[model samples]
Target: MVTIKDIAARLEVSASTVGRALADDPRISAAMKQKVQEVANDMGYVVNRAARMMRGVSSNLVGLVVPDIRNSFYSTIAHALSKCLESADLQLTLSETDDDRLVELRHIRELTSVNVAGIIIVPTARPHPESVRLLKMTSCIQLLRRHASLGEHWFGIDDTQALFQATRHLVELGHQRIAYIGGTTDLPTGAARLQGFHGAVAGSKAAAHVREELGAPASTDFGRDAIRRLLALRSPPTAVVLGSVQNTQGALEELHASGVSVPETLSVVGFGDELGFRWWGPGLTTISLPVSELATACGLWFIHQLKQKSANPAPYSSVSPPTLVVRGSTRAVEAANASRAPARSRQLAG
Candidate 1:
């Protein structure tokens, strides 16, 4: 509970002199500033953030809204964000929306109400018009996701390039029959990744046997269901590219239950470097999203936007390319198995 007054009394200086020193005001002499700082440190004094905000000096608070706290990708980013923001002497307020638009909107309103210096959001579901409107009036940055109409201040890996690279990896491995699992076309990440998959497959020999299993964002149940559907196909894929870590776990469970050996009968590549892979007997080959990098970039962007509130914001933004991590779950396709044609690939094209 040490205050500026306490430090001033001990130094026999005016409280305003101590305040100016604390603010790093150039008017305060360097010798006096150092003396005030030493006294403040000795007295265990800390600037009250709430009081500073009230005085319009600094809010010292940032809000972060994530879709799911349990998701490894989001959690990793949150950890990095907290660490980075803390180093800058700022506090973070975190909220989870569980992919519910209403909940996300409410969280945004609450954060804005508290007058946080800025907000970093990973939106639940697609971008809504109302959310865009709210963002226009607030200092906010979108992280690992984007809203179609929201101008700039977004940071996320190039999902499309990641998927395309994954598909091409399978192609290079002699996997002509490849299936994609998780995420529906309506979601931006899903659509972008799908486009990347298609782009890589186009005009390729394996393009004839590519199949997609689109649904809700990856979950254990969804993973099982998508696998079941893929297995039911007359010519099941020899290799699969999974969209999320959750789906990767579910797929592994289903594969194990069916006694299907990974990278033996089927090769699996997943997105996100889930923690489960560390312990799983067969480590999953995954294209790990740069969560920490994205988070740090978003944090820096949020700070920049807060400082440039009056400047015109950029229109639509994204992060740099993602890095792909290859692990043990996937292997070269057997020539005999790879030679078989996929019926669905032909049907879809027809």
Candidate 2:
């Protein structure tokens, strides 16, 4: 491995001068910095980032933790965040927690121990004690799902509002028997979205129409299972609202398997506008998350924190509002379904 000393020897400059030039320190003349960088590049001299981090120098690495990258929503957020941070000359290190508290805690500790500039996390539903301790040693920006215990800066969507609009859209379309399939209340997102769904139902004059089937983890399997249970009911819902993109995909797969035609037989509204949804048999109506905006805000705030260690920016908890996109998947309830009032009553019975 080529060292800074070797580069300095080739350039006829002190090792200290080479270091300053590589760092682009304002004190170094632009011409000299350019010359040293070109020589360093030719010599294949790499900065000893690990050594500099050990000496308490802020690293150019930022850590990003998410539950599942396979989920399109999280994957999109990760991509947006990567682009935003890269523009500022910072690199991103990703850790997938798989929604496990222990794994989350381990990742947090590992990142902080390596002296990453900061971490942006979509924390697990349950709080881990190790998360609290390690977070104190670094800057953290919570995303999407926040564990109430770790009161960090949060950049997320208005989950409640998102669900409320979705549910209300079905209601407006004359969907009296509507079912909600979503994640458990352990996570803030689950809780907020559930609350929103119920709030819309409670406030609606057609309050008796909505059925909720939450408590399952947010996954494709959960979506599939929830749809099965909903359909098994004597008077199945004429419409369904899914809380996440993964859930939507799973639910739609089950619906397809069951031969239930969308819009004609059942209306559906999904969370997060995944690309595949547009080309699906019927274009899916969904709530579009402002992923780019959320990522930009988190990246900027984290970079600012790294620069001003003492600067206490207000506790930011802003939410990017979601947009409800109408498509071919949702339609007004059929006449036969609307007339089965007694069937709806029995369906809700224990």
Candidate 3:
């Protein structure tokens, strides 16, 4: 409830002088601004955000909309974005869409209604046209997993190249049967990753390989179910690649439950470098997305756009390529062992 008048009276200055000093107006001398700010801080003065909004000024709050905040991938992005926005003197207003189209549209509209400085969204898999319409109501920067219709200001990782390299790595280990689990073909990232998996398998020097399954939604349940089904297959895959962090975690759990030893029984690769992956029983060999760099780039870009201070033209797109980190979870398959194990129906246990 502290007001500028209270600070002004305490500092023996006029309210207008206090306001200008609080805003750091050039007309206010440095010594005066310092004194006003110190007194205002000590008095716990708070800005009249509603009054500023009424005068056509927005709060220094940016909206970050993501599918699931509990997912480590999105959580890491949020952390990085928070740090970047903090340095720029802006606060993050986070919203979760849960990958639901209606929720996504609602979040965007709500943020716009509040006049958020800008919104950064990792949109749902199949965003409706209404969602796009709602997004146009505010300045928005699309994050990972952008829909084709709303990629005007997008920043994401190269999902296709990442998966392609991962699949190729498994192929190079002399395994002919590989399975990809995670992501529906609805979103661009999902479709691109699936294409990358197929592309690698098709181009590999392996004579013939079987693709067990391509799961959907990139959730823990989907990952767990997909791995179970693939393992139950008669000629099961020798390697499995997960498309998301949640999927990787779920798949790892399934593997452990089924007593499948990574690299020995079935090689495993995952998307996104979760902290647990590095220290798990067998370190995961996986594709690592540049979460921090992507968040920083998106935060800076959105901040620039919100302030209209950048000289660059609009319709910006930034892509961070993924990197594959090799670890203990993958190993070269011996040709003799692969041939001998095709019919040994112990259910892919290492």
Candidate 4:
């Protein structure tokens, strides 16, 4: 195996100089660093992660914990994170929690045991105090989610502001009877989104028309069930806003099965632009979550934490606003209910 000493001798530099250059120390000039790197590469010298860990240094491995790896939103962010980590010559270890707190705790423990240099997690619904404390053992960054009491590194979209804007859009389109479908009241994201929905509807003339159904996280089955319940209401909503892309798919399927024409009988808006939306159908009107941007911010934050060596220290946080993408799924209120003919015309025709 090629060793650092071999590279150092080949480059005619002291072993300590080679080490500092390899570490990219400020004391080493750029030209010397480049020369040392070139010799190391030519010699096929690879840093042994085990040796570095034994020396009590960074492992150059990052752990990424996500609620559901199957979800496109999470997968998208994972892809971005992986790419970013790779650029920094680091490796990524991924763990799927399936939105279960117990499973997430286990994953966190495993990552720490491996001496991962840093961790980026999308926490489960409620903040787990034990889990939060455990995270202090390693550099941690929270992504695409937030915790209320447990202050720590975080980066995610402002879901409340996003949902508020979405609701206002429907109201501006004259959609007096608008309903929300997705998320249980227990989850922070769910509760915040609900708050935004109510904030937009409060004191409005159409407040009476606003309804909500707290369901599972962005599942098609949940969407179907929520839609069924909404349609059974005494006065069904003319429009619906979905909390996730997965749920939107289910909602659309149920509506199609019921022979309900979209925008004519019902207009819909969903969160997360997601993949294949354009080719799926007429395309869904949605709030794009800026998944890549959030991932990049999380990766950079994790890197910063790694350098600071401050585990469990709460860092400055930021939230990005959601961007609305208008598409074929949503329409004006009059267009949405055009299927209902005037009572006078029906009586005369009869």
On lDDT, the candidate that comes out on top is 2
Whose TM-score is greatest here?
Answer: 2
RMSD of each: 5.7, 4.5, 3.0, 4.8
Candidate 3 residues 13-112, lDDT tens each?
Answer: 8999999997778999999999998898888888887787778776788899998899987888899999999987899988998888898888887787
Models 1 onward score TM values of: 0.84, 0.92, 0.90, 0.84
Q: What lDDT tens digits, residue by residue, belong to model 4 across residues 98-147? A: 88889998998888776888888888886567788888767777786777
Q: Pull out the clashing pairs in model 1.
A: 152-316
Compute the lDDT for candidate 1.
Answer: 0.78
Model 4 residue 347 CA deviation (Å) reads 27
**Least lDDT summed over 10 consecutive residues: which range in candidate 1?**
341-350
TM-score leaderboard ranking:
2, 3, 4, 1
User: Which ranges in model 1 have alpha carbons more than 4 Å from their true place?
Assistant: 1-3, 41-46, 127-130, 275-279, 301-318, 335-350
The Cα error of candidate 4 at residue 50, in Å, is 1.5
Model 2, residue 95: distance off in Å is 0.2
Give the alpha-carbon lDDT of every model: 0.78, 0.83, 0.81, 0.79
Q: Which stretches of candidate 4 lie over 4 Å from their true place?
A: 1-21, 24-44, 279-281, 304-314, 341-350
